[model samples]
Target: MARTGRRPGLGGTRERILAAARSDFGKAGYEGTTIRGIAAQAKVDPALVMHYFESKDGVFRAAMQFPVDPAEFIPRLLAPGLDGLGERLVRFFVETWDSPAGSPFLGLIRSVVGNEDAAAQLREFVTREVLGRLARALELDQPQLRAALVASQLVGLAMLRYVVRVEPVASASTDELAAWLGPTLQRYLTDPRVTKVNRRSRRRR
Candidate 1:
């Protein structure tokens, strides 16, 4: 008699799968990456990947584990109402990135800068998971556009402060950054000017 199939309690298989997934994702993006491809690279059966991670999205989330749980925080942020949301968002962003927990986010931004596929994947993920939720919660007009505007600001801030490490921005304290960016974010979130701009653009079209 012999043991057929993978050995029980084998170590490294999970890590190997994750590594393969990360590489594949970096190269192919989420839509291009496949379970079979990841399993092949990891030298494991597709079933094994499903067994450990459940699905592609699960694997992606595990591979790119964000320090904060969006489910927990998004609600909390919304709970306080829209008042001061801009400052709150800025504070949260800088504080999170300033902490050790921000490593994954930093890595993500770096990956996005060099890889178009990675950038697309990030855009999809942020829009779908983060900004989309915020926009819907606010019940604002032109939610998608509003969300995109917010994302642009935050992403730009992240690039300067963390990835590029630009002077002043990179060296600034979280409170300083929050104060500087808060009003702008607040405007993006609630200002009627956004609606006016949209109307003007529509008239031009």
Candidate 2:
């Protein structure tokens, strides 16, 4: 049933904006999803949509609330002295994307595949949220660059394994993938040589 003691119209404006954004973004993607379309769908003035979210990007961010926030998970993923972080990272992602909660990720992949603008937004989101945070947690000197590198590798894996469903790799068990990928991630995160050039440049100054 409907939520108790609350009319359908209660909390209507915000809910309507979110609902409109979800549909518009899912269908038309980031670039195609316009304030006018959202306002039309929400049955509210365009100004109202802007009032809730300053821009399209803002609406997109609010609409896509992943079940697990990196703010909560990243610290756990990076807890000092945690051995086998690479394995844990792989396992965490595999488990997350395999579960029902990963529907949003799947939807995001589909959106990106179909729309270049949406693909850029997806890249931005991954960079800002996942890779950026991971870099900071690892205390990388160039957090953004490191995070983008990690995101590229992980996003590629997700695309091939889950979205494309490519043959044996796609069918490969999560544990198997983790075993193969964990070491690479470990090297990326811990290898002193990963950013030797950058370190050397800083040292020279």
Candidate 3:
């Protein structure tokens, strides 16, 4: 069955597509994600993705409403090498959340009740841009899994501190918190699993 096209310039439809793009790109990253996938996620015809975004790159650029350009920052961050990547990353994240710019994140989380779209945007962005970049740089055996584990810590911290407003985890100083969390992320980025854990996990999936 043909999917009917919405009227051109339909109110809220473009926003819906953009939000869906954010979610898809965040989850799959630019290379792994697709326009047709985004269209399906948006509940629109694939033509509409091209109509609104022109191309996959266009969709990616627009979908990334990040506070900073992840591409530029990722390079700069990596240039410093892996010695203190975890600490540097955590410090940056905590600083961003503590700044006025962090307001958008809080607002997004606050508004996320029955609204997973915004959550997806946040999740995917961190997953694709931050974790993905860091993982690849490590050249670990299971880089993606490692990065994902690290992302869980960072995202969990964000949710606790900014969203759920959990007491000590929320109020603790960034350096103090980073000191505790950085090493865990470092392990995920560098740890080598001698067992078939990585291969076994793939088979299970």
lDDT of 2 at 79: 82
TM-scores for all candidates? 0.75, 0.67, 0.63
Model 1, residue pairs in steric clash: none
Candidate 1's residue-wise lDDT over 1-205, tens digit each?
0111234365878889889998888788778899999999999999999997777866776566545655556778889999999889888888877777677787776677787766776676667678778888989887777778877898899988877789999899878988899888888889877867635444443
Q: Order the candidates by TM-score, highest first.
A: 1, 2, 3
**Can you write out model 2's per-residue Cα lDDT over 35-115, one digit (the tens) per residue?**
899999999999987877667756666666444566567888888543677777888888888877666777777766887
User: Compared with the true structure, what per-residue lDDT tens digits does model 3 show for residues 89-178?
Assistant: 788779878976565655555644555655665566667766677667777677777778877788789998887889888899988887
Q: How does model 3 score by TM-score?
A: 0.63
> What is the lDDT for 16 in model 2?
84
List pairs with backbone clashes in candidate 2. none
Instruction: Identify the runs in model 1 with alpha carbons over 4 angstroms from their true place.
Output: 1-10, 20-56, 65-67, 198-205
Candidate 3 pairs with clashing backbones:
26-124
lDDT ranking of the models: 1, 2, 3
Indicate which candidate wins on lDDT.
1
